[model samples]
Target: MAVASSDGEYEDDPESYHSGDSEEYQMDHRPWLERTAVKRDIQDLYTVKGLYNPSLGLYRYRVVDRLGEGTFSSVYLAYDSLHNLHNNVYWLPEETKSPVGNLCVETGHQVALKKILVTSSPERVENELSILENLRGCRNVSPLVTAFRDDDQVIIVLPFHACDDFRYFYRLMDPPKIRAYMTCLLRALKDIHARGIIHRDVKPANFLFDYESGHGVLVDFGLAERYQSPREATCQHEPATRSHLHGQRCRTDDTLTVEQAVYDARKRSRAGEGKVGFRQEDARPAVKTNRAGTRGFRAPEVLFKCPDQTVAIDVWSAGVILLSILSHKFPVFNSSDDVEALMEIAALFGRNSMQRCAMLHNRTFISNVPTLDEPPESLASLILRLNPHLYTPHQPDPTPEEALEHILAVDCALDLCAKLLHVDSTRRITAAQALRHRFLGNAEDDGPDEQLDPTEGKCGLLHRWVDGQRG
Candidate 1:
C-alpha cells in the first residue's frame, strides 16, 4: 500500500480572510508567492525582452500592475505601444514589478502576460502551455492571443480580462449579485465544455466579467484539458425543489443557517488528521504519474478514487465555486493536502472507491464512498447555503414569491448545490447539466447584461496617458 502525504507547505485549515461586513478584508493568511522563489527568476526574462507581434507593429510597451502570482508563474498588467493610445494592457513577469512600476505610462492598454519559470520541469510547463494554447477562442475560454520566448522562459499573452474572478467580486459587491455570477459563468463553461475541453480548475479566481460587456469571460486556462482526457456522467435522481437567487435584501449582521452552522462544526471536527476517504483504490494507477490542480477542486478520478469520474469533476468544483461566491469567497471545502482533499469531499458528498464505481460500468452509478463516521451534518449544510443577495437564484420572474416562496427559493438553491456536490462520483452533475440545472436554467436568460466593462478597452496598459500622463 502506498501512502500519499501533503508536501507540508499547505495549511491544514483554510485561512478565512475578510469577513466582508467588518474591517478585515483582503488578508493574506496563506500566500502562494512565498512558496516559490524561482518565480522571481522567471520575471527577470521580461526585463531583457517582451512580447513582439508583427501584426501590432509595436516596439515598446509598459506594464502597470500585477494580476496574480502562483508557484510556477505570475501574470502582469502591461501595454503595447503599437496597440494605440487608448486602454492597453499587457502581462509581464513578476520581476518586472519594480521596473514596470517605475516605467512611464506610455500607453493605456492592459495585457495579461504569463511568466513560466525555467527551473520548472519542461514537461510540467508543457502541460500548462498546452492547456492555454488549446483553449484559444471558444468564447467561454480565455483566448491565447500570442506568445514570446526568451532564452529560457516562455511568456503567454492574453487579453486584459476583468480582475474580478467570482470570489474577488463577491467581496467587492454590496450585499452581493449572486444569480449573475452563476448565469454568466455557466454560459461560459457551457461554451467551453461544448468545445471538448475541461477547465480542471473551476474556482472563482479563474473567471472574469466585463461589466461593460456584461459578459463573464472564463480566464486562467492553466489547468484546462483537451476534450479527450475527459469525464463521463449521467443525470441524478434528485429532489425537485431547491434555492433560487432572485431578490433578497442585504444586511450587515447576517448569521449562518442551522445548516450553515452544522457545516462549520463538521469541518472543525476534522483537524490535524486528514483522510476522509483516501482508499487504496484511489492510490493512483501504478503506471500513471504527475499530479496537478489545487486540493479542494481536484476530482475523485484524478485521485484514482473513482475510475469513471469525468467532467462531473469540473461540475463539482463549479458547484464549490458557486457556493464560495455566494458566501463571499469562503471556499466550500478547504483541503490543503491530498488526504484532506478526499476527506473534505467524502465528508460532504461521501467517499467512494474506484472498484465500486467500476461496478456501475455500463450502468449508472448508485453508490459513493462511505460517509465520514459521525460526520457533522452542519458542515455540509452551512457550506451548502447560498445567500440570494449574492447569487440571485433562478426563478420564473424573480419579482415575487412571498415569504414562504423566498424560503423555498433558498432551500432550492442549497438543494441543487447538494446534488452537484453528491459524494457518489456518478451522482454529481457535469458542467453541461449544470448549465441546465434547475437553479440556473429556470430563470429567463438575462441575455447580455448591460454593465460597464471593469476592464474596458484596457487590454495592454499602454494607452496614451490622459493629457499630461505620468511617466
Candidate 2:
C-alpha cells in the first residue's frame, strides 16, 4: 500500500482510511500538527530539487491540484511545462513521425498524475506497467502517457478529461448517449479480454467519459490479471485417450458444456491453491483466496469464494452498473461487507436465487438470517419506485399516448437490467453480448473514439487542446 496522501505525505502505518469513500477522506480528522507536517512534506516535493520539480525527467510538470486519494494511491492534476509550449518543435525519430501531428504540446496542457509509494512490492508495480504497455494502442482504454520515479514515489501520467465519471452522467444522459458510453466500455473490455487479460474491477468510478465525444475509457488496472486464452481453455477439455490425441474420437461421455469445461480448466490451472478442482467422484472444490473487489459490485461467485472464477466477475460488476442507471441510484448497494452484500442482493433477487448461487460454488448458504417467505420487489417495481419520473411523461399536461411511450421505455430498460443482474455467472451477458441487447441498439461499433499516439499525441489533455488534431 502507498504511504502517501493526495495533498500530503502518507503515513507509513497510518490508521486505515477504508471507513468511508476513498475519494472523500477528510484531512481535518487528523491531529493539527500531523496534518501541518504532511502538508509541508507535500510542498517540499514541489521545490526545485524536489520530486515534483518543474524541470525533471523528459517532461517538466508544474503541480496544479490534488485530485483524490485512494487506499494506496493519490491522484493529482499537473501542468506539463515541457508540453505547454504551443508552437515549439521537438525532434522525433523517423518512425515516430506523424504527418498531421504536432511536434510540440499545446500550452497549459494538464494530466492526471497517479502516484504510488515505491516501497510497494515490485511485482505489483510491474504488473500494472506490463498491462498498460500491452493496452497502449487501445482506443476505449485509458492511455498511460509515461511513468517515472521520484525519490520514493512512482508517478503514472494519464490523460486529463474534463468530465465526471459515468455515475454523475447516468441520470442526465438520454438513451442514445447511454448507448454510446456502453459501446465504448464494451469495446474496451472486448479488446483486453481477447488478449487474455481480465480487468477485475469494472465499476463506474473506473470509467471516465467525455460528454462531447460520448466516449468512455476503462481505467484502474490495479486488480487486473492475466488468464488462459479462449483457445487454451478449449484445449483443456479435449479427451485424454491416446487415440483421441492422434485425432480419433474416444467417447461421448467426455463431452462438457463450454462453461463447464472452462471452469474445469481454470480449476486445474489454479490447482496450486490447494487440493481443489472440478468435482469428480471424490475430489472437492477449490477454496477461494481472500475477497477482491468493491462491496456492491462484487459478483455472487466472488462472495461465495469460488477460486475458479472467470471474466464473468467483471460481467457481473457491469451488470450492477447498468442496474444503478436503471434505478437512478449511483450506488445500487452499499453493504458494509461481503455477507451484507449478499444479503442485499438476496433482497432483490430473492433468497432462493442466492442459495442457487452458493450451490454453484459448491458452498452452503446456511446463514442465521431467516429467508423471507414472500418474494422481494420485482425489477420493474423497484426501478419504478426509485425513479418514478422514468414512467411519467415529461410534459406537465401530456397526452395518454405520450405517457405510454415513457412507460414502455422504462420497461425495456428494466428487462435489460434483469438479464445483466442474473446470479448465474454462466448465464450472465458478456460485454460483447450486452452490446447486442435491445437497450443499446443494433450498432455494435463505438464509431471513432479518442486514440493516443505513443509519439506525438500522448494524452487527451494535449489532443483536446490541439484543435482539429483528430481530424
Candidate 3:
C-alpha cells in the first residue's frame, strides 16, 4: 500500500521499487560500491526492496520507507502481511462478550518495524521486551505487535500511529488542547507505574499525538526498569548508590507469597477486563543501572547521582514538558551538561533551594558550580513573564473584566507544575495525584478552594530557604 501524502497524492507501490537500482527510491539504501568492513554486514539488510523474493519465515513485512535511524537500529514504515491476515480472523468464540480474547485489531495494518543489529546490547533489548510484555494491549501506550529474530537481525513490530511529536503540536494547539494531550500522557504514566515499571525517559520526542482525536501515546521504553515498590521493599536500610545497586541486584526475593501476588496481578493485567491489578507487595529494593536520561529533562535526584530512582523522575520530566508548552520554548532549558542543567533550574529556584534538595538525597553539590546572587523568583511569576498571553482574556466575553479568572488559571497550572517539578524526588506529585489537580479540573467534588503558597514546597529545607530569602 502506498502512503498518502499530506496533499492527498499517493506514492508509488512499495513492492515494485528495488533499492540501489533507482537513485530516486533510495533512502536507507547503500550502493554496492561504497561497502566497507563495518558497513558490509548491514549493507544487504538495509538495502533490500521490501520482502519481495526473500525469506522472513512466518513474518512478512513490505517496506514502505525509512522512518528513523539510531546507533543500534533503523525503523521503517512497513505493511505486515502475516499480521494483517491474523487481524481478520477471530481467534476466540464469537459468543464471548469480552474483547480481551480478540487479537489486536492493528495486526495486519501499517507498523513501525524497528530492526536492531544482533551485535547490540542484549541487556537493553531484554529490558525493552520485558516492559513491553508487561504492558501488552494497554491503552495510551504504543502496543508491541510481534517480534521475530532473523540471522544477525531482530525486528520488533509496532502499530503505526499517524502523529507528530509534542513540539509540533504544542506550537499549533491552544492551551486546552495541550492540556488534554498532557492528561493522556499522565494516564499512560499511571498505568506504567501501577505495573511496577518506570519509564526513565519522558520527553517531547517520546510522546506522539494525533491532532484530530487529541490522543497521545508514550513510546520508547528502552531506558525503563522494573521497580520494587517502597511499600513492599524489605531493604529500607540500603543506600541509593551505584555500589549498593550492584549488591541489590545480586539479592533475590525468596518469599513464595510475593511471587504468587505478582503472578495474580500480571494475570489480571493480561485479561484487560478489570482495573490494573498489579500492586506493591514484595520487599525488593529499587533497581539501579547506569545514569541514563535526556540532559534537560533529567531529575535532580538522577543528576545528583542517586541510584534508587523511582517513578518521580518521570514526573519531573513530564513537568518539564508542560513548562516548555507554557513558556512557548520548545526546550525550556537548553543546557550543555548536567552542571548547566542544574544552573538553569537554579536560576528559577535559587541555589539555596537546590542545595537543600541535594542534601535530602545525600548527594553532594559541586562547589565550583556558580549560584545566582539575587533571590529566586516564584515559578508563577516566571511563567507569567514568559507567556503573557496566558493572562489575557478572550475577546467578546460576558464580563469585560475577567483578568482575575485568567490569572487564577495561570496560577493553577503553575502550582501543578511546581508540584511535579520539585527537586526533592519524594515531594514530586504522583501521576494519580496530578489527575485530581485543580488545573486539570476537579470533577469528583465541589470543595472549598485551597490556597497554595507561591514559594511553598514539599521539602522543609525549601521552606526554610524561602523564609531566609524573605528575611
Leading candidate by lDDT: 3
Candidate 2 lDDT by residue in tens digits, 1-471 = 123344545434343433232232235455644544444434444432233332333226655456666765777766666653333222222222453333234333556777765556768777887788777766588777778865566777776655676656788765556667777777788566544456888988788878787867888887787542221112112211111111112123323443355455446544555433324575654564546678888888788786555666777787788778767897888999877887788878775677556655555453334443345578778777888776665567778887776666566667777877788776666665666667675644433323335244222122232222321
Whole-model Cα lDDT per candidate?
0.49, 0.60, 0.61
> After superposition on all CA atoms, what RMSD does each candidate show versus the true structure?
17.5, 12.1, 16.7
**Residue pairs in candidate 3 whose N, alpha carbon or C atoms collide under 3 angstroms:** 84-108, 232-282, 232-283, 234-283
Q: Per-residue lDDT of 1-471 in model 3, one digit per residue for the tens? A: 343344434444454333344332224454544323223223344443333223433225655456666666777776565653465222222332244432345443466878876677888887787688777644588877767665556677777676866656675555467568778788788666655567888997788888787877888887878654232233212222111221122123533443455455446544665553223685655446446778889887777666456677888899998888777777888888877787787787776677666555443343333445354477777876887776665444625446666567667777888898877665577776787788775463233323224243311121222212320
Question: In candidate 1, residue 185 scores what lDDT?
Answer: 73
TM-score of each: 0.58, 0.67, 0.67
Question: Local error of candidate 1 at 164, Å?
Answer: 3.2
The per-candidate count of clashes, in order, stands at 70, 2, 4
Candidate 1 displacement at residue 339 in angstroms: 2.4
- Judge candidate 1 against the unseen true structure and give its global Cα lDDT, from 0 to 1: 0.49
Error of 1 at 305 (Å): 4.6
